[model samples]
Target chain A: MATEAQGESGGGLEFHPMDQFIVSPLFGDGGVAWYTITNATLWMALAVAAVFALLVMGTAQRQIIPTRMQSVAELAYGFIYKMVEDICGKDGVKYFPYIMTLFMFIVFSNFLGLLPMAFTPTSHIAVTAVMAFAVFIAVTVLGFVKNGAGFLGLFWVSSAPLPLRPVLALIEVISYFVRPVSHSIRLAGNMMAGHAVIKVFAGFAAIAAIAPLSVVAITAMYGLEVLVSFIQAYVFTILTCVYLKDALHPHH
Target chain B: MATDTHSSAGDGVAAASAPGMPQLDFSTFGNQIFWLVLALIAIYLVLSRMALPRIGAVLAERQGTITNDIAKAEDLNKRAKEAEAAYEQALADARTEAQRIIAETKVGIKQDLDAAIAKADAEIAAKSADAEKAIAEIRAGAMDAVRDVATDTVGEIVTAMGGKADPADLAAAVQARMKG
Candidate 1:
């Protein structure tokens, strides 16, 4: 489908490091109107659908004994509960639902992308940047709402010497701006690296038919990528929590 | 080289814009993201408004049940202690009444035995005194009768036998025989 999209090119385009990062057209132009969905979009949709189905099923019965589905629902609820409580303190409970959705969506998206022929929307810089930007906007808005313009004091630590205040404030502002960049890049980099390594090792399977040694290396890499997927999701969620903490109580 | 590069670029552009080809980043993804966010908002609303309230209600119900159980247990404990105290009081009262009855019965029996014993002792003394008096009277009357009989016999014998006998000596002899 991509070949069809790039119609004339059989294999002429040069591959760059950035090529691994960008999301190109998944299917070439086939006049299907707006009906054509890309693989990334599909996986993303599936993640959303899965989340809905799980939540709906989990809560539909509301049993006292708790069926497996209900338990799964409760587990998710409990996990997010702890996450919010630990990060935002008792007050964090109010935001539990939102944070739970965020964690599940990112985790499911990352895991889904590990499958064969699946596109990781999160692997795209645009997608991650947008998520990061949303978080940034939310945290920023929350800060102002909670602290009013006094939130500006978050950047200027009065504890610093009077002479160093301006410089420290500048640094703080720069760091604050860098939050979204780092947040987005962290997720994007981890996802792209994992997918690239997996693709490279998988490519070796074609050659491993001739060179048996490549099989062992491919197996090890596949195992490593699997571990990496879970770790990336954890890292993403934890960093999100830490960022939210800074927003909730900005100081050091 | 310029011509080759230009013609290939032209070909690439032509391929990219071919009929029935949709443009990349044509807001398709943007629309999807928008819908996804909207759906997310809807889910969040439902959870917060419906599901969350129900969960909270269940938890509150559980807490209420626990509280009621504790309260009931405490009430039962209080009742049990009261009953135990009442039972002990009843037991003590019964013990006191039994002791009183036993002592009263012992005293009553002792009184009846002492009264009967005193009455029998008095009767035996009275009968012994009367027998002594009666015996004395009998002795006196017998003595008198015996004297008369002796006198008459002595007189008759003296006359027949031609021997003299004195009245005083005969009486003395009779009396002496009686004394022996």
Candidate 2:
């Protein structure tokens, strides 16, 4: 849909890099309501299906000696499990399933989005914002519940001198509130930026003189995006663990 | 060309008002969020309910299997060591028993030899004593027979020479001669 821009009209070179992110209805040229199945839904569904195929059906045998898919499933399990345990400590292991869910969803969505003409759900601020806010809210509530009034100690800056504690506390509070915003934006920004750059480069291929350079740029950007996709997912998961750690033990 | 440019310029303004960045379009946020929440929930359910527990069990089972195999191997090794010790003890016991028997047999043979040697020595001493007594008796008998022969020879000579008055006188002469 985006590449079909002004092909018949022999006008100036047209470039609509951001057009790929449009959330149009899959069935028709209609409006996108909250429950409507758009390209976003299709990709999200694909990501879910991919998760099921990898983790669920792949480990159906539950063998001591694992198959390739089973091994990968186990690796993903172990990687996230270790991450949760390390950042959040052993006590934080209870929340491992939630962290794994976020990691697998983002990672899969990212990798799947690498396919040609595919929509990246994680690239959207709305999607990333919701997940980040969910994590933030959950961690905050857990901190309060687990530690009671002591959870506010996260912002109290007990390590500082008593005179400096108030200022430090204010700064900590601001930073604490900003965590979800930064967390969501970081992922969404990285994914969106890489994809947009690649699209911009792809648009330049309309010129016969610089087609090779554009292709090369696209290739490099595509490779970087692949790395970015996984890393962004990883950063998101690790940050969640960090937040969870703070909730579990907010003193330090 | 002028008409085309004007039309394109109007389209650009329209596009700008609608916004080129789809991410900034607030109208679609609800839709994206709704689908994302649904996807996350689906992923969460599938993972927590089915996949994770199975993977965990398989990992746990593999660990347990390894531990059990190692334990079994160690147990067998201990049993083997015990068997070797038992065999060595049996061998040592047999050797001791044989040594004791040999010592007893040697002692018995020595005792029997001493007894035989003592009995033969005593018999030899007794025979030597009896032979010495018989030799003294034979010497005495020889002396008596010599005296009788001398006396008879003197009597016959005296009778022949007609110088003897009686046999008693001749006996007396022989006895005197034997005594000198």
Candidate 3:
């Protein structure tokens, strides 16, 4: 009975036993254990490479009216321009290029994960965590440089009365610290959950008698996931704008 | 799950390919992160320098086209107004010329009537002087003829009477008769 239970526990197929990347501690056959690379890292590099190649090729053939490559380039620029204008106002025009690149990187990374055999970099907490931390650091530093020590007053929120100052400051400080954690987790969690669900459903459908229905469900979910992926990218970029706005104008 | 099958396969790969393969870690991802940042910077530079300007030029070109269209419309309207003014001026000149011709004709008719009246008055005065001269001439001739006739009649009467007396006797007789 024990053997049977053990056999059953280890039976059938389980997709993705490890995280997106499985790191090994050694370099070759026999060596001291050092470090390993994750698949998420691989996908991230792929996304970056793909983006670089696309930009290089897109600009190579510069048609006056615009070819397919030029159109793609124009679409990227125009989309980011509208986003900055809407979220950060006219003053945000200066940051248009940065925000546009960030949006495209996230979008491409998220879409790459949706493929059959591709890894999703966004599903990993560390990747999103680092990116979020960078944003936090940048905005915080900018606020200080722009407003001096008065930037600290952002927590106290000068509008608070003397009696309520300490309590409000404590809450504000907590929320400020929570920013990076939430920002990173929101993207990581959504991506991880979506991919996990798709894998599980695919596994169930693979062995089921009515597999066709499950395929349909999977197909529908994929379409929905694509939409969510775009929305997530847009949300991330807009939030970045909002945070930068706070840095630029510390009152809010 | 499926570890039993994977264990044999894993053992095969782990043993045949590489012996005693160590586990992986998060630090291996560091290099990747570095390259990613570098690539991101490169992409950013390309976008800022190349892509953005093209987009700006397209927008600027669109704006310029609109402004040019507006300027053209304004110019056309100005020209139309000038043409309208010119047409009105020409019409006014034509009317003024027609009025002047009518006025000149009226003055010409009045001048003709005044000249004819002066000519008729001179003609009537000349005809009246000629009639008066003819009347005076006839009156003188009639007087002379009547005196001559009377003298001849008296001579004839004296000769018929066979009077051989001198002219002095005749003159004395006439004077005595007149005094009586």
Which of the numbered candidates is closest to the native, going by highest DockQ?
A: 2
Tens-place lDDT per residue, model 2, B47-124, is 889999989998899899999999999999999999999999999999999999999999999889888888888988
Q: Any runs in candidate 3 off by more than 4 Å, and if so which?
A: A1-10, A13-42, A53-56, A59-64, A89-91, A159-162, B1-32, B57-180
User: After superposition, which runs of candidate 2 have C-alpha atoms over 4 Å from their true positions?
Assistant: A1-12, B1-15, B84-180
lDDT for position A111 in model 3: 91
TM agreement with the true structure for every prediction: 0.60, 0.75, 0.64
| Model 1: lDDT to the true structure | 0.66
DockQ of 3: 0.11
Best by TM-score: 2
Query: What's the C-alpha lDDT at position A5 in model 2?
Result: 48
Q: Is the docking of candidate 1 incorrect, acceptable, medium or high quality?
A: incorrect
| Candidate 3 C-alpha lDDT tens digits along A21-90 | 3332223333212223334446766776666555555756555566777677667767778878877778
Interface RMSD (one decimal) of model 2: 4.7
Give model 2's share of reference contacts.
Answer: 0.85
lDDT string for model 3 (B98-132, tens) is 99999999899989988998888898889878888
Roughly what TM-score does model 2 have, to 2 decimal places? 0.75
Q: Superpose all Cα atoms of candidate 1 onto the true structure and report the RMSD in Å to 1 decimal.
A: 10.2
Worst 10 residues of 1 chain B by lDDT: B18-27
Write candidate 2's Cα lDDT for A145-233 as tens digits. 99999999999987889999999999999999999999999999998888888987876898999899999999999988989999999
Task: Please give the lDDT score at residue B26 for candidate 2.
Answer: 79
Q: Per model, how many backbone clashes are there?
A: 2, 0, 8
How accurate locally is residue A239 in candidate 1, as Cα lDDT from 0 to 100?
70
